[model samples]
Target: MMYPPIHLPIVKVTVLEDRALVERHAEVVLSPGAQLVRVEGLSPLAVDRSLQAQLTGGSVAQARLHRAWKQKPREGSPEGKTEPRRRVDTLEAEWKRAQVDVQRLQSRVEVVNAAREDVLRAIAEFAGAGEARPESWHEQLEAVRASTTAAEEALRQARQHAERTRQRLVEAQAALAQGEQPEPLLVTTAELQVEHPTGGSVSLRLTYLVPCAVWRPAYRATLASTGGGESVTLECEAVVWQRTEEEWKDVELLLSTARPTLGAAPPRLVEDWLRLRDKSEQEKHTVDVAVREEVIQKTGEGGAHQTEELPGLDDGGEALTLTARHRVTLPSNGAPHRVPLFAFTAPAVSEFVGHPEHSPLVHRVARFDNRGPAVLLAGPVELVRASGYVGRAQLKFTGVGERLALGFGSEDTLRIVRQADVKYDTQRLTGRRTRTHLVKLFLSHTGERPVRVAIEERMPVSEVEAVEVKLLEEQTRPPPTKVSEEGILRFELAAPPRSQQELTLAYAVASSAKVSGL
Candidate 1:
């Protein structure tokens, strides 16, 4: 049966990591009877199982998705192709140009080599000619030597040029070969049978998931000193890309963390069998997890949540909504289009951090608590300071009240010199060995402005009870402000302009038996 064409416009799109879920909504006038509605122009990569439709002014009795390959006529046929044929033609032209270059270079090489050979023959003749013109022989030999040297240099250059041209030709040939491949055409159509109560306009929503679409988070962090506190402005953006063969024009775009490929139902538990096999008959089986496809049901849950104020609607536990302020037009060109999602400002703590033992350069860092109502998705961040663009850093998934540290490259204003001393002693009575490490950092602030600084160091924590560790607090200067259970030490201090400060850390490790880790 022929279905009436219902051109649905894409209204919203939720971009995931590797796929996209598109929602199309349109109003159609229907009669008070069963009507066949056909929605076309969908992504060929759309998942058949994920197709869903809803009729508001009508009831959808039946729905089915159909996909077919629509072959385009080859070049030089009555029906012609556009993009694919043009691409192949462009590549062919490039290949022909490269071939011409190769031929030209080859000709030049032959000419250069012939000229070099002629020069060498002339030099050989001059050397063999005896007493014909003894006085003129010296001048002729010098002239021949000059000509031979020039010809050899010219031949070497020409051969080098010829080799480079040959490489270019090979690359062009490969590109042309790839472009010559036949292109496949995909046509997707969704057929729906709807029953309407009246003959008015009826609204319908069609949703489907398609592959080859992805979005990644990116941020721009600007920090400037404001009075005693530092003001940090974080601009959150999304880098969206797709190759779904369907362009999204003037649609509401959303970046989500949904994984629909992983199904919702929990995996059924399988019985584990244990058997003892003979050594000679024993075999090993390798299980591959790389190719395993996981379909996550209810993947819309816990997607990108809004920061600061909570979203009115929750997908499940979290409702991270990064909706574009205005409608955006994104093409299916497989290129990344950056869209600014939102921006927020918060107070932060700016400090100069130094880990002289590990790296000699001191870095300026800003630590701030995520007080915004939205959760920050993990993405790349570009740090900007008052002095301009500092550098780029990666931002991890952070929830509310979580702290994030943004490193702004290196701080050349602060200089640190690290000195470490090791002492080994043997106990005479207990016969146990002991090792002590004394590390000192001499920090000098060379800049004209005073700044806050924090220094970090680490001590090896013994996992076994046999090994004992002790911290010498008396020998340590500017005592550690925080010490993690993992033996990380942090010290916060202030550096005056053109002044110097020193940080000393001392620790001792003792073990009765020789320890493999220290």
Candidate 2:
């Protein structure tokens, strides 16, 4: 036996990076024995292979996705009329009536004008023929003058009515053109076959995946200083965009970073072969060297730099699933809607960071550990403090227990000035060239409270045997507190209020004559 299609309401939705999984539930009464059931009102973008159905009191024998073109009622159709359709119909009727009124009033004005012209012509003819006495001619002319005035008044009123009717017609036309559009004719539904020995009322759940739905991670960080201590509050959220043609109202929402499009099989491996060749006479006599900027690679939790062949969801790291804290309602429009996921507060260490070589302004930095349950994905963060919203920053992928730092806004009371001096020399006997650089940074504080600043500087690193680089420690004043192998120099300084401090750094880069560029 065949049964009518049942309308299922969406109860839950799990949105991923590129798609969404929708779950719907409904209860219906059915007769005994096997019967074919159909569920209607699904998105056309739903995947065929992802359809799944479950029956509580019965068993589902077979389920499949079905697509068909169902025509919708047009405007003014006898079947039915939507609200927007009704509005359009009413406006159209009004416009027609207004057009008729304008034409009628215009005809009246033309008739009145013609009658006045005829009366004036008759009066002029009678006076020219000298057919009446002076008193009679005067009386006739006076009567004609009064009749002409009345005709002109009638014409004016007719023109005014016509103009007002025309304005209403124009307004009606504009509103009709700007009315809301109706839904498309294409529809998707799911068909299922079920069997039950004694069926009465049963609850069913239908789940499927749909495309054109995506979500991305976003964050809001607020830094505040309380009487007890300073803390940073991080709120995690998801920005979802979907056009599934089905509204999710008061449904449980889940945001996941899993990429279902990725395959499980490992990539095919290939063999690597190396070839060597002897150098020519010129290559043996001289060595070539060039200076180029190095690209920095980020290390993962394993403390090793890794690269991916294709970009995955959430910075190409592990997958994470987060549930919304409260129920959400999202429309079918393809617009971004932010949904709150979770939030956490942690103790923060606030400081001022300066990079004089790059910018003269010092920025306030806050360092905190990720004490939340899930890893923080890389996304844009909105920065807020006690003074309200300051600016925005980008947060990188941070794992649990990992420390992360964010720069809020620039410090207005602190100022920095940088200067550099360079000197070059060549030794004729050794055929060697040397370049010396002297860098100076001047810091000033205008605030009443003292503040500590961390200054960062970079030095060149030699990658070839013909070039060498070293920091001239003996000539440099107040050496850097920490120096990494990657040629990063860090200095920590404490500045008193209303005071100025100067720092100097000197470095040398020596290269042999065989080197091409320095």
Return the top candidate by lDDT.
2
**What is the model-wide C-alpha lDDT for candidate 2?**
0.83
Provide the lowest-lDDT 10-residue window in model 1: 282-291
lDDT (Cα, tens digit) per residue for candidate 2, span 377-410: 7778999999999999877777788888888899
Q: In model 2, which residue pairs have backbone atoms overlapping below 3 Å?
A: none
Candidate 2 Cα outliers beyond 4 Å, as residue runs: 74-148, 156-184, 264-272, 281-289, 299-312, 463-466, 512-517
Using all chains and alpha carbons, the TM-scores for the candidates as numbered come to: 0.67, 0.81
* lDDT score, candidate 2, position 409: 98
lDDT of each: 0.76, 0.83
In candidate 1, what are the lDDT values of residues 64-124, reduced to their tens digit? Answer: 8888887754678535645555555556666566666556666665666666567567667
Candidate 2, 329: how far from true, in Å? Answer: 0.7
